[model samples]
Target: MTKLALSDEILMKIDKPARYIGNELNSVVKEKDTVDIRFVMCFPDVYEIGMSHLGIQILYDMLNKREDVWCERVYSPWPDLHAILKEENIPLFSLESQQPVKDADFLGITIQYEMCYTNILQILDLSQIPIEAADRTENDPILIGGGPCTYNPEPIAEFFDLFYMGEGEISYDALLDLYKKMKQEGASRKDFLHEAAKIPGIYVPSLYEVSYKEDGTIAGFEPVYEDVPRTVTKQIVTDMTQAVYPEKPIVPFIKATQDRVVLEIQRGCIRGCRFCQAGMVYRPTREKDVERLKNLRTRC
Candidate 1:
């Protein structure tokens, strides 16, 4: 049997042991040695809240489709479990193998809300990884921030190495391929980031220098390297049918916040609302085809 990061005693004491013990139906597991890249998708909140997110699931499915890659899930442990982990000095681990998140090649944390910023720090601390990007070494997993809050990531910009702006379905494959190539060639972290910045929609915070006026107003953002672009554009999927959809979502042993089959019928609301950012950010609403959606339903 595999040794779990969380002991039996800890599991028994926790409210939901299922949150730590993965192996749910449809959860992909591969031999670590066979995988070229290990990516951990994190939600800086409890498992219930993270599991309910449809965006994470979509990315999870898309990433796992590559034979060379293995994607796992992790979430912020509840306070009761958090205390035990800290007290025992155990590193933060993924649900699938109970392996340390720091060991993964990429630690992608979805930032849905601004409130979870502190929780992101908590995750980094638990993982035994540096909280700030500058403090991290090549041994550390490249910290990536994504989701809605990335529209304006300057507030928590120092913490992350890169931010994936707009929809994830666009640039992840290119990003992962680049990482794999660079890792094989023994490329330095700086070298990788410089190249990664070239990919459309990938924002490498380190490559850009931000300035502020005395009045705390914006001055201008300039690129540190000549090769790096001054502005990073947002990526979006033009056709919904071409995009990959999760056939089966991982089922939790315990009741999740929303433990039901989720179908993303449409993206980018048609209503041009001035107040809401959702309609503005996710523009030119695209939807999945009726027959394709119907076919997807049968697979589940």
Candidate 2:
């Protein structure tokens, strides 16, 4: 059982209590429900920024809608908070329920961008978990990842068990279902990943061997398993206009980027930049209803 969470007096001394005490009008709570699968929706950055992400909110909302799945958010603690936790010997816990992250069944990290590489290691380390997948034991939660960064997952490839290449709304659903089946069979992490790799839009790096040339360019990468694909395409949600927008975004008591609360005005982009794969792959565009957006602004 968890001890009393950081008390209000302490929260006052620290930053942003709105972020930690989640009475947000739109926040969803399902951890207490009996669910076979638990997902730790992680953002590899400090809490202030991660709590502000619309993508993270969208996916978290979608996943928790499933009766069999419970979703919890995790973000890398700020440097000062990191020092505080280390001194107190406290593991990273979800802001909503104040439970340790290690209790989850699946650790789904969102590699939003490449720059957060070191932060990803920081997150796992803060959670009292191993940074490398190879070192983790069976008791460790399965470390799944995806996001724009997964398009070129090679940079932080060593950490994630599998990368969801495409749009997560569909891809992660398949992954969770597949994992439930594998869990029933009592498959090992290696073998479970072997099968998860077979799913479209899922990239299991362990099944593909990477070799680098002297010049530092990738010399070759060959899939050891016939089921694995050479390149995984990032998934894009086709229709986001009708998507559930979180109006009562979790407001942090402390200041943060867009701390006032904002709505996802749109999704994807129409002007596809050639160099922008997120644009190229995530074709088409969807905009939130203007009336709804105005409502969001009013509420905030």
Number of the top-ranking candidate, with lDDT as the measure: 1
Local distance difference test values of all predictions, in order: 0.91, 0.75
Could you give candidate 2's per-residue lDDT for residues 199-272 as a string of tens digits? Answer: 78888777899999898778898899776777665566666656555554555555666565556677667888
Model 2 TM-score? Answer: 0.85
Estimate the lDDT of model 2: 0.75
In model 2, state the lDDT of residue 86. 85
Clashes of 2: 9
Q: Could you give candidate 1's per-residue lDDT for residues 1-300 as a string of tens digits?
A: 456888788889988888888888889888889999999999999999899998999998889989999999999999988998899999999988789999999999999988999999999999999999999999999999999899888899999999999899989999999999999999999899989999999998889989989987669899998988888899989999878889888877778899899877888998889998778888879998998889988997
